[model samples]
Target: MNRVVVVGASAGGLSAAEALRRAGHEGTITLVGDEPQTPYDRPPLSKQLLGGDWEPDRLALRSGPDLDALALELRLGVPATALDPAARSVTLADGVRLEYDALVVATGVRARRLPGTDGVAGVHTLRTLQDALALRARLRAGRRLVVVGGGFLGTEVAAVARGLGVEVTLVEPAPVPLAPAIGEQAGRFLTRLHQENGVRVRVETAVGEVLSAEGAVTGVRLTDASVLPADEVLVAIGCVPNTEWLADSGLTVRDGLFCDEYCGAAPGVYGVGDVARWYNPLFGTDMRVEHRTNASEQAMAVARTLVGPGERRPFAPVPYFWSDQYGTRFQAYGHLRGHDEARVLDSDFAGRRLLVAYRTGDRIAGVLAAGVAPRPLRALRALVAARTPWEAALADPNAG
Candidate 1:
């Protein structure tokens, strides 16, 4: 492969480019991104960046010297408008066509915006750097904020707003926040975590409409017709894949671009990050993970496959993610959904530390730990990857 193109400039695409160079592939590598700025870490956009603890330059994933060393041809601030797999080329927004002998499709997802909030002022969604900067400015003291949805993003935003002394009300239609991902018990635990930090938690409630006054958002009307006044609102329901450009590209794209266990989309083409739904033989299922760890892992695997002949490896990862909020760090590993049982491994009341294990049949399916030091939890990843018995996982901690 003498010419390669890596689309998208986020974690997955950037990792793919770097991995190719590291693998000693002497190819002309081109990295295309929609953002004007250099690749940056996104998880901080909701925490450190939005909380005003970090500056824009601090989020950069690569410095000028770093990119110069890689010698990657960068096409920033221009989005890919269309893809032609048969022609082995991609069309940019400005009508420039980039041909590639191999391609890495890492065009990740975008934030799902709420209806009727597009043109309205005082409404925000935190997906990009600009969004975070604007939101941080509005999170002044004495401001009342309403956050729609109770997912990690919304919950994190609410936590940061409260820390800024902004009165925050987090509304979720589900009885407990993050119940779908972390189970009801753990979700309820997080709900209390936020409430204890001075955030108003409204469970089993949904927003019917955004209430605006004189072309600016004043509040939101609940399903029960009650209104919660707010100086600003953040809609963080979820994200959708940026896969529209691949319409006629002949790649299987439903919720995301479909890939095999090796992250292969088609011949000389691959997918990674939130935009790729790949199968995992270990779990006997297909999943699309948006976490940063999965993105880097998948990209590296794909890059190696592209660089070396017959060096392909299946992308089987022990799913892991971490979130920091209100001075507490929440970490989890493995698949949590469809588990048959859940058990608390450790609960240190004085230390505010808690650990829980999830099991599917006799095998441990997942593990979640809050306020628990990562030094101890690192062992849980290997345990989950090995499909160890839940009893063994519970006992291993005590042995340590």
Candidate 2:
């Protein structure tokens, strides 16, 4: 392979570029992205960036010298329009076509906007640096805010807004927020955490419509016919994989770019980050993870397969993710769903240091905990990965 083309400029894409050089692939490298600016970290966008503690430069994933040293032909601020696997070429929006020996698609995802919310002032979704900056401007003290959806993004945004002294009302249609990811018990705990932090938690409720007047958001009408007035509204339903550009690309795409265990989308084309959905033999499912760790790990894996000589190991990862909300850090590993049993390890609910272990049949399936030490977290992750017996994991003192 003499030339490599990496689409997307976020964490996964940039990491792939660096990984290529590390693997001794001294060939023409092109890093393309739709965003105008250089690659930057996104996790902090919802936390410190919105909290006003971190500057824009702190989010820089790579310095100019660092990027220049890689000799990457950067095509920023423009998106890829189409892909031709037969020709091994990518078409950009400007009609320019670039051929490559290997292609890495890391386009990631975009925040899903709610219906009847577009073109309305004071309505927002945080996905990019620009989105964060715009939303941060409205996270003022004494302002009334309504955050729709109770997923991580919505919950985190509500947490930040509450810390900023903004009166926040978080609405979720589900019985509990984050129930799909962390289980109903943990979800209810998170709901209570938000309430204790002065955020009005509305569960089993949906946003019927976004009430607006004079082209600005006025409030939100709930499914129960109750209205919560708001100065600004944040739509945090979730995100959609950015794979529309690959519609006719001949690669299988279902919600995300479908790839094999080696992250191979086609013969020479690969996928990574949020846009890639690959089967995980470990988890027994095909997952498209949007976490930062997955992006970084998968990018390196794909790069090695493209440049480094080796037997291609399947990309089977023990899924992990963390969230920081209102001074509490919540972390989880493994698949929390399909577990038949959940057992508590530590029972200090008042101190907010709680730990829970999930079991599928006799084997441990997952772990969810807050305010726990790294030692226990690591042990839990190991146990889940190894599919350790439930009794052995429960008896491990460090697991608490």
* Top TM-score model: 2
38-129 per-residue lDDT for model 2 (tens digits): 99999999999999999899999999999989999999998999999999999999889999999999999999998878899999988999
> What is the C-alpha lDDT profile of model 1 across 151-246, one tens digit per residue?
999999999999999999999998889988888777878888888889998988899999998899999999988899989999989999999999
TM-score of 1: 0.96
By summed lDDT, the worst window of 10 consecutive residues in model 1 runs over 391-400
Superposed by TM-score, candidate 2 places the C-alpha of residue 219 at a distance from the truth, in angstroms, of: 0.4
The C-alpha RMSD in Å for every predicted model, in order, reads 1.6, 1.3
Give each model a TM-score: 0.96, 0.97
**Residue 368 alpha-carbon offset, candidate 1, angstroms:** 0.9
lDDT of 2: 0.90
